[model samples]
Target chain A: MTVSLRVLDDGAWVSVNDAREVSVSELWRLDDPSFCGCDLPDFVVENVLSVGVDGRTVTANVYGQCIGCGETGVPGWVPVGRLSDGKFVDIDRENTVLPVYDGDDR
Target chain B: MPTDVERWKSEVYGTEIREHLFRFAEEGWDAIPEDERDAWFERFKWWGLYHQRNGQESYFMLRIGTPNGRLEPGQLRVVGEVAKEYATGPGTNPIFGDAYADFTTRQSIQLHWIKLEDVPAIFEKLEAHGLSAQQACGDSWRNIVGNPMAGDDATEVIDAWPVIQELNETFKGNDDHSNLPRKWKVSVTGTPDGSGQGDINDLALEPAYKEIDGEEQVGFNVRVGGGLARNEPRLARDIDVWVAPEDAAAVAGGLSALFRDHGDRENRYNARIKFLVDEWGTEKLRETLQEDYVDFELETAGDDLRDQYTYNAGGEGRNDLLGVHEQKDGSNFVGLNVLVGRMGADDVIQLADLAEQYGSGAARLTQRQNVIVPDIPDGELDDFLAEDLLEHYSPEPSPFMRGSVACTGTEFCSLSIVETKNRQVRFARWLKENVDLPEGVEEFHIHLSGCTASCAQPQIADVSLRGMKTRKDGEPVEALDIGLGGGLGEEPQFARWVTQRVPVDEVPGAIENLLANFDDQRDGTETFREFVLRHDDDELADLVEPEETSYEDPMMHNTKRTWYPYAEDDELDASPAPSLADGTPITSDD
Candidate 1:
């Protein structure tokens, strides 16, 4: 099945299967060089996703090289949408938000 | 009296620690009592485990100590396999997946997303490879650092590898030093090239020679109390004592013991060895060490062979050992920049294979978050260069990328506000593409700290950026404050903050403008730090400030009248009055 992908909010959010599936603030490992080593992977979200729907869950077939490794045409997939409590919920990226700084300012 | 941390340790020693670990592994995080969690976390640090992602304490970060930054290919393969097996890829849960590792400035490996269940297996694997996470963190002596090019460099005053190993064997898992007032850092180096940064550790033993009974003796000159923290930044002071090679480890252990017993335990901030040294003075500390700790009489060193800051075309001052260099043994040691010290498991394994095949069977890590593969024969240097791993960890990197150092940013560190590793990488790439320097300017040391802790050593860079949050047009945004002219060596000075809060988006433009202006107006001999020091603070600030656009007055019909809203009357009078480039002045309507 073919699925549509849209980049929202300046590469912050990724809309997959007509739902905002990932937020840069939530999922991307911004501090880890592997994910955020270069400029935002604009190409990753900008490309279309050929997704497959299985019951209440949807899996998107994503193809792109990691911006960090710069390896292109690598096939990868991510969970785009899932059903929880009888409602479809977009799968948000995890561990992207940092702790608010409350330490000594030097 | 023991400090709170020390007291906690005394109560929770031996079987208690094992019990805590067993409980953590069997029951998982949710089963642990809320009030007892913080203490357990602190206890875990003694085993070289820390909560991953500063504030979010779900998974763990395990630090593996590499003595003097030396690792055999076999040991590295184990670390690589660990990263591939347990750390990398998707996690069991959202909070604990995609394991990766980073090389710390102290020359240790930090692995993230470590679950308690896997800790035992990881520990067994590490021990099998003669590696341990023990004492990687905590109040005990951390990793014993030495010159990464210790035996390889011909200019080295003395080989520090043996001494580093001696100290490591003496201290690792030793309960005598398992608890201290705070974390203790140590470095032992004899590189005459000044690549060894011994002046910034709690105890630094540098190469020194002295005349005794008319015969010159080679040994170490002790420097004590050097540390860098938020409120304290003190270069180590010379203790005026020369130690023989055999007695070096004893001197280090004695000093650590002294600090452990005498260091202030009430105020955590005032508990470093630096504070105690300041309170007792170097003279008293030396006297005590000689009188109380050692069996042999310590003599004062007359000659110092420590490295001094000198000009190097390929090196960043005397402390940097980046790029290719000839060894004393007629071999070549290639220092490759790891770009903020992040390397994948596959890359690590590949590097190990390369090191074993073409060069030595060992690799060394530098405090700069870079690595060195030494003992490459003169004939094999080309083949070593041709290795695919060099493409990612390049020996020949741009000056900015070569000198860029970053702390673990908000990604895994809790104390940081902005993400630093990727941001720093992007900034270096941007600088390389946008800015060009004048002749004689090759290296620009830019250090980025995720927060004020200065783990990246930002205070010692030519250009330092500290992360912070600032308001931009009434909305809060990530930002960094700029510091200039900071450096280390003979005349080390902490950088002065030039701009308080430049928006993260504008930092590149600001740095580019400043560098461009400097390139246009600098003397051929002046280094970037020297050029910055020559300028007035206000002038430097103006050089780096973002560009401002001006609008022409519609009524006057003259487009050349430059506005000086913030310029002082004296300043305007000192220079030519606000006028066009052609000296045309439009009359003010008022």
Candidate 2:
């Protein structure tokens, strides 16, 4: 099941997978480089029902219980990141010496 | 029989009425006839208003907004009349500002046990006397709080009343501002001694030095993204925008519009403008805001407004709502202590009378729950001292009153988890009587909030208390969650929750423990905030409770524990815990 990521200032990750598994730990090996987080399991992917982005920063959604937990930490978004998915991304804050941004900088 | 409005008003009953009506099969106002509608409505409204959480409900509270804690003579008299009418009973004489009114930290009047229906008439009457309750509550700007002693205090660099009035007019009920994606807050300061806590608002304007046209001029150093509620307690982050006074309102309006247009409405939790600012970096926000303001045709202040409004970086160039100080007018300044910002009618009248007797009937409310009576002549200082009100509420106050504040907790707020006013007063009085704080330790704040809503802003207090409930003998009882090391202004930081679930009864003792540590550890001229931050969680926790260092039982079990994502400790084996997710264990407080 797919899950959304909630990133902290220090690079830690928390994801509530579709199978209702709420995992918060250091990043494991990811298939893609840009994502910078761990890979979730297959059964956890089965439970993913829906997802949404929170103001372009964090991703959130509703999902069924994780195969791991007996209905614990199921309904909330655990923070994680997305890889390139065959696309390019830019780091906006790092662009200018002190970036003066305008609308749609996102 | 005709139907009565009381019979139709299902929302009138408190939680207690549900059980009583069910058990006795008793008829409520619902059974009253239509012809007796007005009489029934009056009786029912009175009964509802009279009903306090304790059931005696004898004291009905009416809160009057003193914009940034300012009040005129007539306003004071209005409050006095309300107190005289409500707080007094058959045998009980109202205690002036005690059972009467206690001037609040926020500069508002709150009278207790006022019948609900009479509230409309009371508001109308106050309006007749040149006051309105429109900015009091609900999806509105609320009161615009400025430095209480705006113009009179000699220490200030510039008077903030004009700017405060400007913003209040520009944004208060402006249709452009009425529709917000979430609630927004704004505060302005004329000097660096920030009586206005800068980090707890959506936008904060502070006095800072800047270069314009090759000369140093006073410009507002703007900060954004400060807020407190639930698990999201954060100080305002700095936005690289130094605005002149003339441009302050436009910036305010621009930010308001930005929040209205772009802030999150889908999830109420992520609704505040702070969340949006944090999510979109402050630099990006500033850029967008510039465009927004440009589109709105906001006039950027020319040098004329800049040089005219030079902010005075006065004595010590820091906050001072406590202690006797020299004002710009060359008169003595007296700081009146109002514990927890709960001002009543008699208290308002007394303060107004004192102000008139001593100065020009002008008083300023401090961010701390107290009032500053400035510009008193040397001769009148003696007369000011003779007033009997000074004993209970002193001008020569202690650190507790100078630093202590409590939000309207379970007493009135439907969102509150515990009672705040009585608890804060009890604790403040107890500490003053018992604890002998370090001499010259003029300010030390202790804020008690009813819940995580943080209306009292517990995060900035030297020793902060957030309300919680712990099960004692299988019943939930009120308690406090202790926080340490919050600072405001130039070096701003959010206080960390140090101790969890301290029973309300033990709050005084817990404070005693913390103060005892401060006495031993503090260097010369160190604030309580400095002392707490100097020590880690273990060290701070040890100071609060030396003998037993156990914090586990209270940490996980209590609702007051504000949870956040934590990185797992590598030392713990990655054994999959069954109930929770596989992977490492992480917690909010690292």
Best by TM-score: 1
Taken over the whole model, the C-alpha lDDT of each candidate is: 0.67, 0.54
lDDT by residue (B127-242, candidate 1, tens digit) is 88888888887778899887777777787778888898889888876778877878899988877554556777899888888887889888889999987665368888899988
TM-score of 2: 0.66
What docking tier does model 1 reach?
incorrect
- Weakest 10 consecutive residues, lDDT, candidate 1 chain B? B552-561
